[model samples]
Target: MDSTRILIGASSAPRDGWLHLDHGATSEVDRRPSTDPSTESVPTGRTQRVEAKGELDRADAASVRVALAEWRRWMAPGGELRFDLPDAGAALAALLDPASSPSACDGAETALRARADGALWTAARIERELESAGFDGSRVRVDGGRLVARAFVATSTSPSNSGMATDPTSSAPDGAARDESNTAPSAASHTAPTVDAPTRVLVWCGGGERERLRDLLATYGRVLTNRSDLELLCVFDGRATTAAAFTEAAGAAFAATLGTAHGLRLGCVALPEDAAGLEALRAAAAIRIAIHDEPLQLACLDLAGHVDPARLARAIGGGITEPANGALDDELVRAASDLHPWFYPVELAGHRVVPGLGSPCTPQYLESRTAHRRQMLVDAVLERVDMRGRRLLDLACNCAYWTSAWARAGASELFGLEGRPEHVAQARLHWSSNDFLPEGAWRFEQGDIANAADWKTIRDHGPFDVTLCAGILYHVRNYEEILRWAVQQTREVLVVDTRVQDGDEVLIDEPGDLRFNAIESTRRKVVPNRARLIAVLEELGLSCEVLDVPFGTALGVDHDDDYAAGRRITIVARKVRSALPSARLGTSSTDLR
Candidate 1:
């Protein structure tokens, strides 16, 4: 009932209301009276997220089962329980054979052994135990020497609660109280989300030194010859410049420079004031990089969306001044930080592309977790089929990573389709540029995967030799429809890479057996097991072969049949053959090559 968090573990220092339970106190915890008059009972179907770390590894299976039951009771509907346990194989080896090698019993194992409950814990066993304790969407994976498990506590009623809890104290008891200020805007202009970054950034310099300075910085971005669509707008409020005068001058320059060449709408309006005006502009432009020319106040609107206040404060705390050499280093940094949400978290300047968002997907950020998997998929596809001078279609192509790779592997023509316009723009700016692919070798289009018009466009592009459907099947709701369309579009091979359930039997029309909503994002994603997937592919007049490469194994992850239900699978479905040949489908490395 109180928003205050309650912690129960073996921590030395204890905070207010935190019941720090040790190994000795756990018995008391188990034996405590169910009906306690002193404490207010948590509302039924209230959302509770229980996170247990380190301590679960030291506890026995029975103790864990008891803890799970207690946590489930405390959880409201749609509540989650996450735990981290010691790896059974690694920990047992360390405890039982302590003198064998100290390497086996590392710091975590040795420490946990001191308080060991003597119950070995494997990823699979942990998942089974969690499920037996009445939890849905149980996902357990091994990271390092620890087995991590996460699942939502199963509710008695159907999941119609919308996962929103209602406070009994509030007058409006339908759901939780929301801030009135966050209501939808009265103006239609304020409804649109922030537009993607523009192809070009144009600045109306009131002549002289500022004009030359504009030229220096304009090369860094797409600096539009004419206003196409306003992603970024800069108004010069100089010593003698007015907002009206700046707009007029910029319009004239745009007309004279690249008139009629531009097709997109250019948002060139006077600076806005007030919440509605600011929201309208913020929604329209990725950011309003207001660079002042002294005597100007610093007041930027906080949408509280993706841009963090702390990060923004650190970036724009001090005003940036052009260096003596006229380099816009400081200005660029400020702009980069401001446009961080718009950029694809990667800087593609010259031949080098560096990470901007610092996520695992980019090599500059983390060690590229999917690099090996991607490479394996590419290698597997190339080994079985020859793609030289062939046309290819890449579905759900994120920034044309696979498109470019396929091109390099000898695909003469490529068409990559993505749902996000931002990704399409980035793909055009980086991969499809003249420096990377030849003028007409590859093209990237933005369209919804579920849309028939997008499939028609792909169909118009001609029957592609190989249709690479990777990292996409699981995100979409109507995957069968899309897959059917993809089969109609592919000429020879259809490379399917996605997550599938680890089971011998395929799941079809099994209502209540699988979660209607994905555990991760509540999005409807059906993960078919190997058998179901192969059967579906075969039904579509294609023979399927599962690649030999172990899925998600390189990143110290084991894709075993355990706590985690979904495992990454790469299946090469051939349209020519009705069934996979024995030589091609076998597990031998020689057969794969």
Candidate 2:
């Protein structure tokens, strides 16, 4: 009764002030008091706000009815209950929509199959169920392919719910009448949404390193290609040389690599390497790149010099220290000294870990990208294959970000195999730092997926329910062998997220560098087009479909252009009991092009 807010199924990232509870023992909340159903019922009549996201659809009709009754009983007068469920009605409509793309229909079908466990609830049916559970006012509507509902407990001044019936066409709650054509209830009114700020890169050039400057510019050029929103500012020491000298060298490098400095919003300014210069640099960017004779130093700086341990933990894996008198913490600076720049932002300790600057894959951008990918996977594969009590294999799971995500989604057992030992160590560090997963529930092993001997180590883990091959397919030349191994090890579903070409298979050869998180060269890899990738999966006895990217002006996060341009894709392939129909080129039912 002390807490006024309750968030069910908060997964890994539970809010600070809210009372969090999830279904299984994997979450930290499950260890707390009153979490066990056999011990005690949830405290009633005190919570002012309650939210159950993606939880109601996991239970049957009776269980959902009971849960609604319990929620109603637990709410104080005027308390609000908001929840979202997979919208079966929306999926069915999309399936019937002639204008819906083939990928959309495939996604719709996948969603429908996922909710076939008698947990499907349309908007009207959910509103009626809420009214039956003694809610005075309730509103249900579709948002982001889910049935978002809001119900309120009646207060003394509010109308009684005794004989009220919910209108199927109405947007208002019971005992209230509102125009249906008007705007629907604001779903995000209660929560403060995270704003995705633009990514700014501060390039600190110490001078006298032409090759280093060229290399840095080349790296940024590759990372920031097709990304126009990111800003790159090169700050040079005024004492070292004239601003013009630094600008000239940098301009030549930028021109050679990036084609032009103007396209990248690249600029150069002279500043002394003192407190004033640091302040100026701080005002300009969040991520800083220090170019020196030694290896490049990448660190995220807090402009205010505010020392937050959690943020430090997220930025660097560990090394928390207290800064004195609002000064920049020396320990934090030292920790970031050895850190390699991250191409993909990894979520650690509830915040995203973005080690480098101006990659277009900032913490916010990657967070949005991850959410979009997760939603697509849910609609395509996860909705049908429940993660609960299932085993997951993450092949080439760099730092185990997706592995941890599956654990949060209720996968009982997780095994992550990566090519780099450093990444394996990082995966272990992530698991140790986070308390969402129980001990012995997950394991991280270091191995190359391209090695046949490594497959022996992976096979020892046995057949897995779900196999994840994200960010690995386009990096290997022997992709067929990898796919066969994944299919042989997977029992139900295999989710693959990779970069694909448009036409014939293309081979790209790039340097194999640990800094880029590429253990192998692109020369040893083949970037298969979308059609070829699907055909291979279908040949392996799995039905495959390319998941649609949700790209629109309404989305706040800046997604990478590769996704929008169909150069990158996420395909979910499910194992079939019988052989899949031989899908000829351009003739497959799942051809999304």
Highest TM-score against the true fold, candidate: 2
Candidate 1 regions with alpha-carbon error over 4 angstroms:
1-366, 433-436, 502-522, 550-566, 577-593
Those runs of model 2 whose alpha carbons end farther than 4 Å from true positions after fitting are: 1-339, 350-352, 357-381, 511-514, 521-523, 552-561, 578-593
Per-prediction TM-score to the true structure, in the order listed: 0.38, 0.42
Tens digit of per-residue lDDT, candidate 1, span 1-593: 34123344554344444333333223444211122223333334453664556766556657888877766665666677667776533333233332435565454344232222324344434555665666654654444556666777544334331121111111111211112211212223333343444322222232213322222122111122223333334433244455455444444333222222222233333434355754455455444333222222223333333222222222222111122232334334443322222222233332123222211111111112334555556666787878888898888776666556677777788888877665666577666333445787778887766666567668778688889887666555556667777877777989888766645432222222223212222144455566767776777679888777634333211232111233667788889653333432323321111
Model 1, residue 1: displacement in angstroms? 29
Whole-model alpha-carbon lDDT for candidate 2: 0.55
Whole-model lDDT, candidate 1? 0.46
Per-model lDDT: 0.46, 0.55
Report the C-alpha lDDT of model 2 over 1-593, residue by residue, as the tens digit.
23477777745356666666666312333522233232234566887988888776557667788778877877998799998776654554454444668897666555444221234354435655786887765655445567677888755332211111112111111221111211211211112212332344545555624543444454333333334444455655566666567766665554433332124555555543455545544444443323221212334433232223223222222211122222444443333323333434453443334333222112223333455555555555665567888898989887676667667778888888988776777677667657647879888898888766678777888689999898777777767667877887889988988777766765544332223334643235677677878877888789886777766311112222256667668887889964344433223322211
Give per-model CA RMSD.
25.2, 28.2
Q: Clashes in model 1: which pairs?
A: 45-77, 46-76, 140-563, 194-283, 200-222, 200-223, 200-224, 201-223, 228-264, 345-356
